[model samples]
Target: MSVLERFSFNHATAKFWDQREAVEACARTGSGIGLWREPVQEMGVEASAKLVQDAGVQVTSLCRAGFFTDPTPAAIDDNRRAIDEAAALGAPSLVLVSGPIPEGGTIDSAREGVKEALAVLAPYALERGVTLAIEPLHPMFASDRCVVTTLNEALDLAAPFTAEAVGVVVDTYHIWWDPEVWRGIARAATEGRIASFQLADWITPLPAGVLTGRGQLGDGCIDLKRYQETVDATGFGGPIEVELFNDALWARPGAEVFAETRAAFANALA
Candidate 1:
């Protein structure tokens, strides 16, 4: 396949502000999309699935599941439902955020929660033909978003499961600064743990909540093409997804944001 075949845009790059427009844009661009659960639910999963299916667009991965850092039975049930949604939407992977440290809990304790949650939900996801892509959120988000902070950590957590059921999401914005990133990528590939590949440039002056500050493709310091080359060298051959959480992009019209992001993604590859 051509390099274009490797390109994809996470709908979250458009910030979930407009669901229909985002899907339409992905269809028009012939790009794959990574969708979030809330918007999919709001639009109705079947309806959203039909929209993408009719548009001839691939849903690379569903934005999230696995926030059960507390490992409650209810949380595992919720993740099982997410797996069903992903299957219904024809999403190949279900991105797992692994959630944050629960209230009055330490990061270590929260990580244990993640392991237990995964053990509970991984089988269900496998049965549904969905891979759980454990995403290592930036360390800045360790307290409130995800306890998984490194690709290596994610892989270690997934070691007990089959690759078809558990794997990791390599997102530049989160793991770029890690000294072991390259090794992590190589190890992930060698171990058959590369469930998803995503990109976002790193920007400074992080916004409050640090949730919406992800940089556009070429706007920050990440060496994106190098990552693509490395992963491709490993024969991963999966969608190269762009997932940005930027307020500026979210504030713009979805059409414009989509166009601009496509251009930036191509330039990053160049």
Candidate 2:
């Protein structure tokens, strides 16, 4: 199949786009979608699920559900809901952004909290046929966003659970700077834990910093093709999602941005 067939457009790439239009566009192109929870919930879960199911759009993975720094009962409950949402939507994976270090907690301790929270939710995820995909944000985000900073660390965190129950998101923008990332990709493949393979480029941030710095595919300095090749070499034949978070992209029309991203994915990996 062509790379476009394997393309999955993540919703946040065009943050303000209408979810239904996005799904319809993906359906028309025979591509896939990575959905975010807030919009899904806003549309009503069952309604959103039915919309995608009817559209025959592949739900690549649910956007996010992992902020268990403290692992409170509330946290566990919310994650459980997220797993249920993924199952309901026919999504295979639930992307997790292990949240920031909790109040007065050390980074190590927060990570441990992720382990604890995963232990509670992995079985739930496995039972529902969804993988909990742990995504490591760049280290700059360790304090306020995700504490998990490397693919290796995310892999290590996923180690205790069965691969079907937990896996890692190999997002190029976040892992491109890690020297051992290629090794991590191979390891994820060997372990049957490459739950999602995402694409984005690393570039200097707009005024806001790391979160907004994901350049369009090939727009920045990241070797996106090499990353794609390495993951493909590992035999991970799954959706390659482009998940950019640039304000500039978000400001454009969703249809225009989606079209550009789809073409970019093909050329960057060519």
Point to the candidate with the largest lDDT: 2
Candidate 1: tens digits of C-alpha lDDT, residues 112-211: 9998888888898899999999999889889888999999999999999999999999999899999999999999999998989998988776667468
lDDT by residue (tens digit), candidate 2, 139-257: 88899889999998999999988999999999988888899898888899999999999999887644465577789998889998888889989988889999999899999999999
Q: Candidate 2, TM-score vs. the true structure? A: 0.98
Cα miss at 48, model 2 (Å)? Answer: 0.7
Model 1 earns a TM-score of 0.96
Q: Give RMSD to native, each candidate.
A: 1.3, 1.0
lDDT of every model, 2 decimals: 0.88, 0.93
